[model samples]
Target: MSKIRGMRRYGFLASSIGVTCAAGLALVPGVLAGAAAAAAPAAPATTAGAAPATGPVTGPAAVPGSTQSLPLAPRAAGRTRGRAVGAALEQGLRRADVRHFSLVGVVWDNPATELHGSVQIRTRSAATGTWSDWQDVDTHNTDHGADPGTAERTGGHIRGATAPLWVGDSDGVDLRVRADTGDRTDDTAAEPPVPLPSGLRLELVDPGDTPGEDGPQTDQPRTGDLSEAATAASAANSGLAPLGATEIPALDRADTERELLDLRGDELTDAQRAEPHIGARPRIVTRRGWGADESLRSPGFVYTKKAKAAFVHHTATGNNYRCSQTPSVIRSIYRYHVKSMGWRDIGYNFLVDKCGTVYEGRAGGVAKAVLGAHTMGFNSNSVGIAVIGTYSRSKPSSAAVKAVARLAAWKLGLYGMNPRGKTYLKSGGGNLYGKGKNVHLNVISGHRDGFATDCPGRKLYAKLGTIRSTAARYQGR
Candidate 1:
């Protein structure tokens, strides 16, 4: 069983062009905000709307790795629409010759709570040729407005800054923007001019401090414990172990039949075979435990019971071994969760071993209501599945990944789980697994996100987007 954690919060704000400020405020410099923050909030726009179009828009190439500062002030007092400013910035970026980038804007409120502002850019392409259609990357709102002092200030001070936006595959363009309040009109014609760098240096900041060190300076107190925990967990769980040298028990032909029988009509033909390979055979059920009482203590425990969501996790234990074979390992995991870490049973409702064999953990038939201990708040409506190895560093075999996908598809069909079109991969503070803002499927996520331990590694988490995408494809069919 794998440990699960919560998600993080990242705040982004948009301001008019002509805002100027320092560059140390984008993200926590030297720190990767956690996986918790990596999960995007409900985006107001379509997921496909987040990225720029493939063709070129219009405008000169903005310098790579340079700040394009803008100065802005509301035409009327007490009226600050950050969205309008964000739109202008998006247009500006689209006009610039940068590609594959992350854009962020910050609005700083003074002691009296006036909307002073800043912005930053991190690009992975050089400035050349024409601009591409601007895509609004993900945005977040930190609790900076929660502070009475910072929230009450007025007088729209525009101080924008752009961090050294690195064009990873290109020469690394740099662009900057500084707010100039001299012109106070609502139109771009009255806005301040853009700043271009004479020459730029593509210096790489330590990945650790990239967030906090690069953006506009702020007095906002940092809460980074969750971020650190997410990072550690991701690091620990990444990568797959080499095929273990030890030979373990193989699934009997009869046992395979029994497992498939449980699925009824959904079982695949290949799913019945014990050894598709001659040398090694993967076992589906290594061990089975029954509680003292037959009524409530069936062969399996209910990890979660929900008809809508699917929770995915990696067995932090090594790959050469199957989790079913090691009941002690599962017991240790459960003890740590229930007694020490404070969770119900080992988080997952079902466990998948290295050989792509599925074992029942929390059990409830399709007819009877099944509940799981997988996701914290939503377990009552989810099916928790744990793959037996760390996939962050090691990729799950094609067969294993495919097996999990197929199982999820079957479960989704059986349970009537709607494709929420929201990917839960961005679980732990937005850092656990996957990439991008769009959630392709409803509630499909990795384990490290729900708790603090590194159950599923990075390499495995990266594939989550594909998994959900595939699920969506299947569901569409």
Candidate 2:
């Protein structure tokens, strides 16, 4: 995608983040005043030393490491009249000459404004001069993998950041945004006109060779030295051996009759290691198996005994990737979540590709309640399973849905949760549910059910019923 050739850039207005209430949109006190007071140094309209060009330039200059803010101006191509209220209006599109960048996203400074817009981008394929078709970028996204009620939401480089979409191996780029005006139910007579968001930006994340470029690299596991005594001690204390660390190679295995005989009780029991938590295990590529470089994430694992539910989500990183590129996609998301969003690790506990292959997401054992940063208010007891692409309007592949069922059956059954049943999760805040609020949700639910936004998309959400039923069947219900 390319940035618009020439447009007058303006420093966008930065608004403090507002709370979403049942009544309607409400601004936090002194938020606007504080934003207005500190207008200067908010953020420059464009990168310093990079001059605006007059026309579209084909080749891009090598940018060492930069997050340039390209201001988008309203274009006349947008339709207004007779347009349904609250529907997102395509504001404008901008293109820039960014050579060799792996990640792309839209950013703004208005936290007070609920900007619901979708970004579509077309990238110039390096292998060929031909351009790719425009793909959708989730605009209603607010999840930056930040811890609930934590300053990571309001602090760091993500205060007003929209979810960053991934576009691998691209030089040319173009982006467009449409502010969501639907779902508005305020008393217009009493409330003043809501201000539109400003300081529009396109953050390009180029972290070099998509970490683990030479395929997946094996490293030391999360646990310390893997010895007979150590394994027994850790297993006795933790109730579960660190076998999940197998793929990462934290410990070496020396097969011997004596060693095999010694492994009798310390290792995972045959029943505990079986799939479906009841029957044959489904195929799952571990984080190490999928080539995840654990070096990019924080150490230590957060767990909750057992998983009660599975929250489905879309990566929202665009759908321009191939099944073969799934590893790279996961790696990029891992980096963005840790380095950019400042989370402990990748948010989701598992990721399913369109091809139906399931990959382990956060580092903890697949069977444990490895608390994920997904589903803002309910990450603790739930496992977040993110399908790799946007499914708002697009239909999820049958294989993908089946993969979800297989995963839900295996994981949910670990705690004896029927996929078709209901479960209660205590909210951790950062969503429509109040913190400490106990919310009853479907055992298999979309991200929207817990939050107040559209996630897992309508298409994917619609498939939850089938997914649940299939998952139940997989559990031999």
Candidate 3:
């Protein structure tokens, strides 16, 4: 008679079956004789009167309609209704503010009696304060039914409803039950609980608004405006046609009568017959004076009275003695430039050979000359011209760079200079010439800006921008 007086006599006969089943059928046999006199068992009745136990003892039954009692064995009333349905699903997953979760297994549905499962939650990122990890799930309640009969009615109603199978990085686990009375318990279920595991109902999402395919995309162009628009679309598709001052070529009269009949006499000298003569004198003498034993007659041409332009120098040496190949090897380089560098005959005012011949140096006409070496504080109103050899490491021939670009566009249109805003020498120090100063020659330059060596190296100073774009397409700019 005791199991707490048989659960208070089946909780007062289930509170009098709604007032004795509303007084009918003679009050159901006086409410089964007042539930058999309230489970009559005056203590001494273990064996002497075991027959006294009647209604209240329907094999530990009571809940036909309520004050919960049924626990004699449907596996101890499914382990007391799985610990009151796992304490009402851990108080409804702690009122649904679920924490890091994972369950993944539960699904009852016995034809829509519903009970779902499957968890994988991850929260805790109040703005990247970090947490989220193992995500992936299913059974989020498509009317919760067959997932092994909702994990055997959530392991017979829920108490530690057999969860743990989330294999990685182990966390607070414990669920993996099959218990529909097959009793198995690893128990540890109480903290902040609830019926959560239903893919923990997703909602936090914002790892920078998550859409990934590995992120970032846009930026690339400046290599100097893509090499100046590929050098102005390769100089407007280069078929080359622009120089128009009526295409200026003329000057031949039999090569100026065989270059003034190879300048008559003891191979000339006397400062090569005192300079002056230019274009029509191909027996070329090109003098360099003032050192035949010094004496340009006392500062005779010390920078020819402060010259203003002309500073070109290019004899990167190497002459394999073919001195223009022969006329007695060009008179032994005209007596080794009138006896060894002590000039007076070859300080170039024009030389160009490797077969694009144009010799007469230190002469005059190429807009008047005055040979005083090439550049160095504007070598006496300059006029150097030399193309004897060593174009830094070979590259002249295209008919000797187009006959030195047609004698530097006909001597920069006979020196009214301004080959694109001049300015030549640059190791600092200002104007000895004009436009951007320091030896401006209005056209050609190089010899490493007037000496201190490397005479025209990087392959003819990389063709000085194609000889200043062929003297700016022959000054038509």
Candidate 4:
């Protein structure tokens, strides 16, 4: 079957399963792996003798003008049987009826708490005025791992989540959800019933798409005071142009030659310099290269000292879009992260489109250890590379797979790590391992390896062996 056709088929299969098994057999942590839990990271230390904050968990307020959250009250909820527990949109959110919203996600309760639920949605397609089949939202999400000292964990409006599935240029939406009490302890009926997720919310996100309206203007060149000829080239190199107009500029041969002149000031460590040479860096479209509107983000990029491992993931936005729509898809995600989720920026360190195009994500330089919100409990010393589509049952394009290998080889070699070898990452705090526990993992691993989620999907996760070999070859291992 053609790629698009396969994606639609997957969508149909997902929806069918969702309708039939919405409550009974929803996604469990062990479905992907055999419940081999990683150690959760250690909790934050208190100040001197101060008591820990043990108050009720609160959700962050909705982003101003970009998103609105509507409550979803339970319908015929039954705790004992787990049969009558489901929630639907209080009022149907038809795209035709509500013309303003562009994206949707189910939000609830505390960021630190886990939510077990199945969500299915059907959207109207703009290409044909027909409504598409209901598709299952990726519910086994473990992307909430934030750095211990970072604002994202202790500060931001974090909450329980499902991957936000996009419905493009559509006019209608129907959504249903069933919350499962994920506890599987078998000590009889002595315990209090696991609280049905309180404050179940549906977030309607508006992308604010328009010419010169989606985001603030890109920053001007830092070399603005240079000669006009120099400044013009610098502006283009720095991604000062508007979004969508970016063409992923080629690396300047002269610039590369000059950088080669300095071996002492290189970002690579002394040990890495002594190791077998990996090939030169791969072509990367920087944040400036993709025309990211820097003014939309909080200033000053954060960085870790070195990246010891790379975690792979799928964006989990369905595979309905063409390659030409990649940039637009990225832009929408950017707006969603910053505007709707109240994140500082897009969560991944980099994004790979199906066409093999690599776009820089986050504000930090490509060579730096820019912390990302991709893997739960393991963000500190790692890099997250997300392919831009779902691959639960369908195969990923070869180009996308090749891109992962190339990017992994380059980034891992920078830290003197072998793409196919194992490395240790200290957990910040997660279901897998306790905080501060050093966990050994493959140098390049799927999101599921470190967190308890079926991310990067089954098909793509299975290809990690091939990806590892290809990357090792690239590193001259």
Sorted by lDDT (best first), the order is: 4, 2, 1, 3
lDDT of 3 by residue, 1-477 (tens): 001111111101111111111111111334534543343223211122112222211121111100111111111112333343342232111112323321122323132232233333332333344454644222212211111221212223222111111221112322221122212243465332224332111111111111112211112111121122122211111111110000112344233222222212223334323331222212222121100111111111111321233444455334332432322222222222322212233345566666665544432222233333344333434455656655656776555555565565544433334444564442222122232344433446664564444555567667766765665454344
lDDT of 3: 0.31
Report every candidate's CA lDDT. Answer: 0.33, 0.57, 0.31, 0.58
What tens digits encode model 2's per-residue C-alpha lDDT throughout 84-197? 323224544546466566677665665434555556677765566567788766666565354455433444344345666776777677666655444445435333233346
Per-candidate TM-scores read: 0.33, 0.64, 0.18, 0.70
Question: What shift in Å separates residue 444 of candidate 4 from its native position after superposition?
Answer: 0.8
Q: Which candidate is the best by lDDT?
A: 4
Error of 4 at 234 (Å): 9.9
Error of 1 at 320 (Å): 4.7
- Model 2 clashing-pair count: 16
Off-target runs (Cα >4 Å) in candidate 2 are 1-97, 109-113, 116-120, 133-135, 143-147, 150-158, 178-199, 206-279
Report residue 56 deviation for candidate 3 (angstroms): 99
Candidate 3, residue 76: Cα displacement in angstroms equals 76
Q: Tell me how far the alpha carbon of residue 408 in candidate 2 is from the true structure, in angstroms, after superposition.
A: 1.4
lDDT of 4 at 369: 62
lDDT of 1: 0.33
| Superposition error at 345 for model 3 (Å) | 30
Regarding lDDT, does 1 or 2 come out ahead?
2
